[model samples]
Target chain A: MSFKDILNSGKFVVTAEVGPPKGTDIKEMIHHIELLKGKVDALNVTDNQSAVMRICSMAVCRICLDHGVEPILQMTCRDRNRIGLQSDLLGASVLNIKNVLCMTGDHVLAGDHKQAKPVYDLESVQLLGVVNSLNNGKDMSGNDLRGATDFFQGAVVTPEANPLEPQLIKFEKKVKAGAKFFQSQAIYDINRFKEFMKYARRFPVKMLAGIVVLKSAGMANFINNNVPGIRVPQELIDELKAAGKEKALDTGLNIAARHIKQLKDENICDGVHIMAIGMEDKVPIIMERAGLL
Target chain B: MIITKKRELQELMENLKNYKSFFLIGCSECASLCGTGNQEAIDSLTESLKAEGKEVTGGFVPKTGCQVLGTKVELKPFKEALDKSDCILVMSCGAGTQAAVEIFEDKPVYPTNDSLFLGNMTRFQMFDERCSLCGKCILDKTGGICPVTACPKGILNGPCGGCKDGKCEVSPDIKCAWVRIYERMKRLDKLQELCDTVLEAKDWSQNIKPRTLATRPEKKEEKKK
Candidate 1:
């Protein structure tokens, strides 16, 4: 089923993300896509995720389509100017990729390409507006389009972002800029996510609580230290450490399943976006354990 | 107002190789505060040129390097020295450097300092950029912090997911500007005010090229009368 239909069905929808390979060899990436085809409502193809050079998400979206899986094209403002970005959006539409996750991607310095010029011609908030304009049969510059797009555009929110006020402000702007749905940053604290939901509930857009699988204490600590807008609760870290190296992956899966169960049973938000990172094969098992399968 | 840092002495020396004699101009405003156009800076350059066996026709600091009329009047007494000089080297921001260009249309002009940004003097000899001059001001919505200047990515609504430990992804030393704005907004109790309001796409037309503002155009008409 399409992501839009799943959202409108009033049922808890499940989605997963897959990163494109850095090199042209997509053997492993295709394997992951096939594994997730029947399980997820949609799969987000990350575009140069974390600013690291990878195969563009558009190509991977087409690959997903070929595999009979709905793909959400993740677009970032790091590599493309407004003209370039608009042109690519049109291309994605023509290719029949409907869902887009608009974002102001991570800075170039955070990725491998420190020397690459960052072309954030339009920030995420502004990119959403550009999508709105495209849907209305106009380009960002108000030029007439030969064939405009109808994209189910989405954006991300960082509820755990420090001094949450600015993030909250940007969240509302995304809604106004025509974001139909949201997928939050990796959330570990259920209580904190609930607090964030209190504010999110007032908005008209649907929200997908983001659950990042934590494989080990070191991974949790690494994400906490390096990734912004993500905080792994101390207790979860201790629990992962307690699981030891051999059982860490299984422990992390249980943690992810537990959160999905709570998020689904409690009806905290519309759905959940499971980010298993390299463990795409484990997503279906997590779904099964959470009784979603 | 604007910050400037001196170009390397090696670059300055290379530019002076063609000119046998030079005239130096400095600004007493921002340049002085930035240690670029102060009296000592001019004296140091004057001595260095003299040591290089080049004629230092004259060097004087101006009250305001950008005030063309005022600088023109201030430079009248140095006409003989300027007449002897092959080039005018301005020890101030680009605006000040261009001011000399305008006055000495006949003489070649070069800048001794690189013009930086519109900023505030954070401490002695330390300046921090505060405004990006994006033409549109959103400080009222951003709790008085200019995201256009402060954020490395210049994101309107930010502290992107890359920000770590309340610092920018570019550097550990650079505190994320959005974090500062959030704290400031929280302290001011205006955090709730932005829940519904969205800072829309900036009207970039406000920052169109060659921005001009005539503060007192009526006074010019009155003076003409």
Candidate 2:
């Protein structure tokens, strides 16, 4: 079924992320897609995540289509301006790719290309407006299009970010800008997520709780210190630290499964978006551990 | 006010090597704080030129170099020195340099400093950019902190996912501007305003080049018509 159907189906949906290879060789990337063919509802293909140059997300999404897996084309404003973004949106529409996630990507300095120029001509809210405009048979400038798209677009939010007021303000703007669904940043604190959901429940759109698997105590600490909009609790970090290096991976899987199970059991959100980073193969195991399989 | 920084002394001298004499113009405004244009800057340039066997026609620090009419009124007494100079070396910002260009139509005007941006004097000799002059102001929405100047990516909504430890992902030295705004709003006990509002995408077209504003009142003759 299409991603939209799954969203409206009133079922606990599951989605996973897929990062394209840095080079032209997509053999390994495609294998991950095949492994997740029927395990997850849709795969979000990242666009040069962290500003590191990689294979195009559009190509990987197209490959997913050919391999019988649904793809959500993750679009960021870091590399492309308004014109390039509109062209790519049309391109995605013509390819029959139904899902697109709008975001203001990471800064270029955060990636390998520190010297690269960043193009933030349109941030997440503006990108959502463009999607809504395109769906209305017009472009951002009100130019008519010969063929328009019926894209099931989504946006991202950060619930556990420090000084959460701005994120809350932007979240309301995203909904008004035509965001049909939302996928949040990595969240480890269930109470915080539930508090955020108390506000989110007022919106009509579906929200998927973001889950970044912590492979070790060091990994949890790294995200807490290095990654923004994410708060890995002290208890979780200590739990992983207690598990020695050899069993840390297993412990992480158990932790992610537990979070997923809670998010589903308590109906804190509509679905869960699992980002294993390089461990796409372990997603099915997490689902199985959470009893979703 | 506009902040400016001086170009290297070597580059300035090379451009004016052909001219034997120069009249210096300085501003008492922001250029003075930056140490680019002031009594000290003029005296140093005068000494450096004399050391290189160049003649100093004369120099003065005007109260406001960018005010064209006011500067014109101040230059009345220096016509003799201005006429003797082969070139005008302005130690103020580009706006001040252009004012010289208008006053001395026949002489070549060179700027010793580059105009940076509208900034705040955070401390002595330390300046911080606070506005982008986007032709519109949204300081009310952000509690007076500017996202355009603070964010490396200039994302209008909020902090990007790259922020870590309340610092910008681009550089740890750069504190996340949005995070600062959030804190300030919370301290003021108006956090609900931040939660309920959403800043729109910046209208870049408003910042189009060569922006002009007419803030003066119209003539009474025009008003009567």
Candidate 3:
């Protein structure tokens, strides 16, 4: 079933992140896709995830389609002006790609190429509106399109953001701009996420809680210290520490599986979006442990 | 006011290698306040150039270096010194450098300061960029806080996923611009208006560069007559 259909079907959905290789070697990416073909409802192809330069998300999405898997084209406003963004949306539609996730994207400063210019011509909310306009047979300029797009658009939110009210305000704006679903930032604290869901449920859109599998205690501490709007709780970090170096990966996967299980059993929201950054080989194991298999 | 910072002396000297002598010009307005075009700065540069074994014909700080007509009138007294120079070094913003370019068609002109952003002097020497001058203003909707300028990404509807602790993801030192706008709007009991308003895609054509404006009155009266 299409991702949109799955969301509407009210079945507990699962999506995973797939970052394109920095270079042209797609062998590992293809392998990752093959492993996750039936495991996820859709695969979100990150556009230079964490502002690091990588192969374009569109090309990878096309590859996912070739492999008989649904792809979510993640588009960011940091690298493209309005013209470039709108044209890429059209190109995605031409390639028969359906799902698009609009994001403001990390600033170029955070990336490897710190000197590159950032083009935030449109933010996430504005980009969502642009996608809605394209779907409605009109451009952002109100000009008619000979052939309009049919994208199932989504956006992102930070449920754990310290100043949660502004993020919520922007979240509602994204909803009004026609976001069908929201795949949130990495979530580690389930109770806090549940509280956020309580407020988010007021909107009609589906919420996919983001679950990033921690690789180790050190990685969790790095995220807590560096990554904004995400807090990996102390007990989880200590749990990974107790697991030792070799066992940390398994422990992390188990932790992720536990979150997914709890979220699914509690009927928290719509589903979960798992991000196993660089650990794609372990996602299936995570799913199996979560009883998803 | 437009902020400016001095270019490195070595870099300026490398650019001035071909010139045997120079006539320095400074501005008394924003540049003077910024210390880039003040009399003391000119004297220091004069000393530095002399130490480098280069001739300094003359130097002066005008009331407003960018005022083409006024600068032209003020420079008449230094015509002989100007003619003796191989180049003119403008110790002000790019506009001031261009003013010298317009005046000295024969002599080469170079700017000694890089014109930074349009900002306010928050403290004695500290400046903060407050306006991006995107042509369109949405300050009314944002309760007077400009996200376009303050937000590192300039997100219209933001406090993007990167906002943490009411601070920007780029740096903890910088408060998230959208958060400030939200707090201000809430204090004014205009959160409803903030929520109801969905800012459309910006009219980027309005921000097209090399922008020009002449605020003269329309010729309606003359045309009617």
User: CA lDDT of each candidate?
Assistant: 0.89, 0.89, 0.92
Over A68-94, each residue of candidate 2 has an lDDT whose tens digit, in order, gives: 999999999999989999999999989
Error of 1 at A26 (Å): 3.4
List the lowest-lDDT window of 10 residues for candidate 2 chain B: B194-203
Flag regions of model 3 displaced more than 4 Å. B217-225
State the lDDT at A207 in candidate 2.
97
Q: What is the alpha-carbon interface RMSD for each candidate?
A: 2.1, 1.9, 1.0
Q: Would you list the clashing residue pairs of candidate 1?
A: none
Writing each residue's lDDT as its tens digit, candidate 3 over A181-284 gives 99989999999899999899999999999999998999999998878889999999999999999999889999999999999999997999998888888889
RMSD for each of the candidates: 3.2, 3.4, 1.9
Instruction: Give the candidate order by descending TM-score.
Output: 3, 1, 2
Candidate 2 B-chain TM-score? 0.94
Cα lDDT tens digits, model 3, B41-140, are 9999999999999999999999999899999999999999999998999999999999999988887999999999988898887899999889999998
Query: How do the residues A166-219 of candidate 1 rate in per-residue lDDT, one tens digit apiece?
Result: 677778878988999999888989888989898899989999989888888999
Q: Give the winner by TM-score: 2 or 3.
A: 3
Q: Please give each candidate's TM-score.
A: 0.88, 0.87, 0.96
Clashes of each: 0, 0, 0
